[model samples]
Target: MGKIKKRLKNFKAPDALLLICILMAMVSILTYLIPAGEYTRFLDPETGKEMVDPNSFHYIENTPVGPWKVLSSVHQGLVESAGITSFLFIIGGAFGVLNSTGALEALISRTATRLKGKEKLVVIFFVTLWALGGAFLGNFEECLAFLPMQITLCLALGFDSITGVVIGICGVAVGYIGGVMNPFTLGISQQIAQLPPYSGIGFRLVLWLATLTVTIVYIYRYADKIHKNPQLSLSYEVDKASKYREEISSNIEFSIRHKLVLISFVLAVIGIVYGVIVFQFYLGEMAAVFILLTIVMACISDKPVNETVNAFVNGAADLLYPCLCVGFARGLTIIMMEGHILDVIVHSLTGVLGKLPSIVSAPLSFIVISIINLFVPSGSGKAVIVMPILVPMADVLGITRQTVALAYHMGDGITNLLSPAEATIMVALGLMKISYGKWIKWFWKLVLLWYLIGIIACIIAVNIGFGPF
Candidate 1:
């Protein structure tokens, strides 16, 4: 027993690459055990995307995945994920070039000086802002653009790197759960369920407030502890390099070139956000903006052509590991889909939930969505895939469609924290150099708390008849 406890304490997360491989291999095995099944797919009139028809469930002949095919899926995943993989590369390279300029550190130095004594207030403002973004706008991938900057700020503000990364991710994550007006998750799910647009937002707003407050306070408490006792941080050992940053002296001037590059980045981010929300730009377009920003930064700095090109290339190269991890993660989904077991798993899980009591079924719906989301992480995509089946299932079980949507929103939101298959989350971890194991160790407590609150909220929503149906 003592030996067993020692082994458990010493366990570390498998590297990102190995974790994806293990999961992919596990999923391949499941294809054999779970019967092959499928639901008919049709285009959604509103979203102009293909959606599974809930009533179209049917079992087909088993399509067992072979070892050779499973091995081949690694390549297939990269091919399928080419678009996102490329976008991640550009994101890394863009930030890498910016880091090379030392602008973020300079800016953090200035900002940290102003907030010298108001560290808790600083945490509250940024965490709330990001949470609002996730709750109101479905801002998951877009939020990744801000983590590196936040890491620098957190370190400068006397917090550890984990605190920096958490501040960036946790709020948006909570907001994803609250999902007040988030189009990607709740909006699409509700619309598919044939409910009123953004119905039950009053309750959602309350959830958003409650969740945001919990996360903010949680992050602050952690920040306060680590700020005083730096040794207490999970990232403390690896953080020394980032923690004891060379203090930027107040008298040292930020050069004109640094200001130009920094201003261009800020404007570029604002423009990208507007383009994404208003013009509906996606991964490809976002990549273009960063590519453009890289050129602008290079030119404005008046550096030699060789230096600029080298910096851009090196920056992109630095992100190679995370980008490959995204490909492998995408491959896992490909293998499942190729083996024709994706629908079967969904069918199996929902069938079990459909038999439970309404209150129990409602909370289990959250768990089911969370499971499926590991295979399908895209917000709107998951909504399209699962909501069709879950919406109707909820009806027969006497569960509200609004409640189902809430479950999907909350479940999907929470899994994004731990899903290595998620592109932005992977890169966000890459930014901090934190392994998945370390993150899980530190993060599971907050997630457990959120889980409790989520179940209780779902019960309340069901009791009070949350819906426009």
Candidate 2:
């Protein structure tokens, strides 16, 4: 009993995130089990009508035939989960190999060594790197590789590790939300809405820059605080610093295989840039190309081909659990839509707040999305569900779709830093040995501050005619 209690006592923030997610899933399941009216009707997208079916066990109007139909729907969830997990795994593995080969380490070391006297500048540099990486790469999971390096840089500059992780993750989260030309979410969402292909790039680009600036400034101020008073930082621990230093010093070898990986990585970047600029490949297709390139590079490195394949497979496998969790979360949305819960919630909220001006409407949009995030974590998927409703609502209130989009982005990005639904944040908290309560205690203030800034920025942008009509 004592041993169990001790173990629970030591449970970290990531564990808490996982626990919260599981609890949410349980709630979702309970909601499904409860009897609800009008859940028998499924909407026909093409006909713009809801079709009712008496049978709960059979298919009707191409929607799941009944509540029990979700059993078969699990297959669809598994397939989608597998695809996302596998992709994340491969990307994460490639990033891990790149780090193991010392490319990432070398870069971090060189940069950190040079910026010894300018800690605030270093923070800005990492914020920029992570922001651009998220915008161009469109892979949030891969930020895991860069995170430890940022923590190390922060420690080297006498700052807390939390500072680095928060800043980097926030920057990436924002970039992912404000993705300018990202094919995954933005492209797919626009396509679903029948918007012209990439027509909103100009607006997205401006929003991206504005959000990036706010993030950079926020991080710089925090970094300045740590630089001036390292002793006061919550994340500062002498033993932690010593341990990290020892690890870095022990693994400083720069092998020829690393050089090959770096060269191939450079070529892959050039190819992606060309594809985006010249061939105009969508972000998802571009990601496929980059993953292929990384696989080839891994094979060509000093590691045996079979070993490289195994490494990649192992990497991909790591993502399975989180991916499934996300899918299960999606299942809740499926259930809600079928159960008329979505309409109920949407109808209630819209009825209450549908009459506000753009300024109030914008912030309310963010709040609604943030609340929704508790149930749906996938930004792209959530956008599909929320944007259709919010956009039209915004239009009725004389707000532009772009303003609505920004609200969606802010809601999505802000909660990611604090939400248990975000698996990557859980993974990161686990890696850092930080408790969820502790991390929230440390970061919630920053998250709230950034959320306010982001909301204000969106309002300002909309007023200045930066929104898409």
Candidate 3:
């Protein structure tokens, strides 16, 4: 008894990778316990997206997964990650090349220097912009461009990397959750459900404001805490090097070459925004743009071609862990699908909604999408998979599709800040050198608060009949 008690007392939280592995194991075990089931899926002729038929769920026999298959899912996840993983590497390498040329440091230092006295204002300003970008544009990967500057800016402002993570990553995440005019989640879901495009903008804007205000307050409190006592930061032990970052930024003179390089970098970001909005390009095209910018930056900075290549490789290598985490975490979904248990879970949850009161079930839709997001992280993709079923279901229950959209946004959007399968969260934590556990330690409370607020918002929406109907 003493031995067991001592072991429990001394137990350490598993590292991120280990936690993923354990979750995978637990999921594999569940395949045997939960009967394998599925819903009928058909290709939507109009949108060309596959969608599930809610009424078609039924169990199949003898679909238990073996240890070997479960283990192999890790590799399968990597294979599935070719698009996202490659995008991360390319972006990391692009930033790496810029860093090698001293241009990156110059850019950050200039901003930090300019914002010296208005540090808190700087945070609020960028947080608002990032939130707006996320709300309106559904900008996730495109926002990675600002991370280098944001991190250095945090160091210069006398806060640790946590603040930077909050500003850069959390800022956009909250905006994405707002989904007011976001094309990917709200827009796509509305279109597929045959609703007017951008319907519910007023409601969503209100959501954005409420959520963003809370988010700003949440982040500001933490920023103020670290400012008062740096030791209070989640990344404090790792923050000693912050001064070195400051020193590096401090000494650089922002030379003419650096200025030109900075201009080129700015053009690259503009080009990215254009590509996303106009061209509607994705991973491969975006990666190509970064590559082009990298080569251009290296040449203008007078870096030797071979040395530039090495630097890019090294930079991408640093980010490989998070990219790999993305794939590894995806293995959980692959295992669930392979065992045919994914549909069972979805069906079970959605089916339960019919039994509860509209007030109760309406808000619980947020939880529904939140649970689904763990298995499927892509917002547009999730919209395709879920909105079809949820749209019809909402009407049947005398609830509005707009409210379901809100629930879906709250579920799929906010959870990305912590979901293992979310590339944004993984990439941010990887870049900031903060462990997944530390991020959860620092940010989970706010997420819980956000969850409560979302529930309340949903209840209010149902009560007021918030809709285009």
Candidate lDDT scores, in order, read: 0.83, 0.61, 0.81
Better of 2 and 3 by TM-score: 3
Which residue pairs clash in candidate 1? none
Candidate 2, residues 1-469, lDDT tens digits: the string is: 9999999887654445355545545545655554433324566476343433322222223222254645544455556555455555555566545544556566555555666677578767767777776665565665654455566556756677777676678778767656675554565445544466556567667667877887777677777887788776655663264323313342455556666777887787677657755676543654586587667676656667777667666655544555555455445455555554543454455455587777777777778777777656777766656666666666678776666665666677667766665656765664455567777766766677667766776677568655446
Q: Pick the candidate with the highest lDDT.
A: 1
Q: After superposition, how far is residue 361 of candidate 1 from its true place, in Å?
A: 1.6
Q: After superposition, which runs of candidate 1 have C-alpha atoms over 4 Å from their true positions?
A: 45-47, 242-247
Estimate, for each residue in 326-415, the C-alpha lDDT of model 3 and write its tens digit.
Answer: 888888778988989887877788888877777988889898889888877889878866787788788889888878888888888778
Relative to the true structure, candidate 2 reaches a TM of: 0.69
- Indicate the residue-level lDDT of 227 in model 2: 77
In candidate 2, which residue ranges exceed 4 Å CA deviation?
1-14, 29-80, 99-109, 133-164, 176-207, 224-257, 270-340, 355-359, 457-468
Distance from true position, residue 358, model 2, in Å?
5.2
TM-score, predicted candidate 1 vs. hidden true structure = 0.94
State how far residue 168 of model 2 sits from its true place (Å): 3.8
Whichever of 1 and 2 has more lDDT, that candidate is 1
